[model samples]
Target: MKTSLRILIVGQNGQVSQALQRRLAGMGELIVLGSSQLDLAQPDLIRAPIEALRPNLIINAAAHTAVDQAEGEPQRAFAINATAPGILAQVAVDLGAALIHYSTDYVFDGRKPEPYTEDDTPNPLSVYGRSKLAGEDAIRQAGGQHLILRTSWVYSTEGRNFLLTMQRLLQEKPQLRVVADQVGAPTWASTIADSTALLIERWQRGQPGAWGTYHLTAQGETSWFGFAQAIGESLVRQHKPCAMLEAIPSSAYPTPAPRPLNSRLDCSRLLREWGVSQPDWRSALQQCLAGQA
Candidate 1:
C-alpha cells in the first residue's frame, strides 16, 4: 500500500476482473491483461509479463470456468486453473508480492446437509473442481502471502453467468423448468471486488488477517429455482414479459458434470478474520439489476 503500489490482475473482461478493475481503479497502478496478452495455458510465457511488471500484488482472476465442458478436456482445464496458479504463486513468492486467487464451491461434493465450512474436506465432483482444488493446494505449497477465496454461484450483468442466462430465457420463453435440488448463494462479482479492495486497505494499514483460504460469498442460501424466481420477479416488476417458472428435481435436467446438492459455504471465517461481510444474495441481486438498469 505504497503511494505507487503496482497491482497485476491476470484477467480482463472476466466477471471478477472487470469488477476489480472498477473498484481498485484509484487504489494503485493496475496492469490488467486478457488471454492474448497473458495466456495461462502457456505456463512458460506467464513469467515474462509478470516479472516485467514487477507488481506489488498479483490478483489472478483468470481460469477455465466452463464446468461441463471441462469434462471433455481435463488437461486444458488443469493447465489454466491449476498449473498456472502454482506458477503465479511461485513467481509472487519470488517477487515478495502477495497473491490473491479466486476459487469455486465446486471443490465440494455438496453431500453435506449444512453449509460447508473451511474445515470441510474437498471432494470434487468434476474436472473443473479438481483443477481448482489443485490450484489452491499449489498456492498453499508455495508458502507465500496468499488469499484463496472460495465463492459460489457468481453472477454479473457483464459476464456469461446464471443471472444473464435466466433473464434472457425468462423473457423469451413462456415457461421454464428450473432445478431446485442444487443450492448455493448467488454472489455478485462486485461484492468480491469491493471486499478485496477493503482487504488491501487493511493489509496496507497494518491490520491484516491470516494468509490462507477463506469462504467469501454472499450471506444466505437458495436453490437455483429460488434464484430464478427472484430474477423473474424483478422482470415482472419492470413490466416485462416473464416466464412461468416450474420447480423440478435435478434428475429432470441432467448435464455432463454433476452438481452438488448443497453448495452453501459458511462465510463466518471470512467475517471473523477479515472483518468483511457481504450483503444478502437477494439484496446483491437487486443492486446488480439496478446497476444494469
Candidate 2:
C-alpha cells in the first residue's frame, strides 16, 4: 500500500459504515461522512467533498436501505442509491482511486431454487431493489476500478437491522410470527468489514483479484423464523423471557414492498478469487450477540 494512502468512507452511523471505520483505522487516513456531512440524496454536491479529499480508496457504505418505505419514495431512493453511486464512481475515476460499494441480493426476483450467483440476471421485485440495481449499472457505466459487493441479510449489534429488532421484540412479546418461507443468511456487519479489510490488504500486497461484482455473506442459510428461534434461544440462556416464535409464510405478514422468498447468495466466487471466507450465520450471530454482553 502507498505510505500516504488516504481513505474516504461515505457514511457514518450505519452498521457497515461503523464496522468499516473500526476495521480500517490503521490502514490509512479516514474521512467518514454522515448524511449531515454528505447527504447521498444530494447528488450534485457529492463530487465537491470527494474531490477535496482526493482519497486513494473510496468506500461507499451508505444507501437508502428502507425496503418497504422506498416504495413510496422512488425519487429519493433513486437519488441516493442510483444517482449517488454513479457520481461516486465518476469521482473515483477522476481521482484515480478504487471504489468499494455495497450492493444487495434484492436485485434478484428469488424464483431460483438455488442461491443467486453474480452471473444470474437481475429482476428486482420492489422499488428498493430496482434502485440498487440501477446503482450497480451506473457504477459499471462509469468504467472505473470498482468492487460491487452484493451481500444478503446484513445485521449487527447496532443500528436498524434484523438481529437488533429480534432481540428486542423476542423479550417484549409472548408470541411472534416470523416469515418462514423467506430464507437467507443473517450476515453480521463485522464480518463484511473484516473481509473488506482483507481485500484491501491483498490489493496493497499487489496481488488483487479481478475487479467487479462478488457475493459476500455468511456460510449457512436460515429463514426469518429460524433466525428468530435462534435469538429466542439466546434470550432463554440469559434467563430472559423468550417469545414463542411461530413460523408463517410471507403472505401472512404483508408489507408495502414485496420480499424475495429466497435470498441466499452464492459466495464461492469471492472465496475462490479473493481467498476470503465467512463464518456460518449461527456462529457469526453468536459472536455479535456476545459483543452486546
Q: Which lDDT tens digits does candidate 1 get at residues 1-293?
A: 56878999999989999999999999989899899999999999999889989999999999999999999999999999999999999999999999999999999999999999989999999999999999999999998899999999999999799999999999999999999999999999999999999889998888999989999999988999999999999999999999999999999999999988999999998889989899999999999999998
**Local distance difference test values of all predictions, in order:** 0.95, 0.94
Cα RMSD of all models vs. native, in order, equals 0.7, 0.7
Question: Tens-digit lDDT track for model 2 on 192-216?
Answer: 9999999999988898899999999
lDDT winner: 1
Sum up the clashes in candidate 1: 0
**Model 1, stretches more than 4 Å misplaced?**
none
Instruction: Note the clash tally of each candidate.
Output: 0, 0
Off by over 4 Å in 2: none
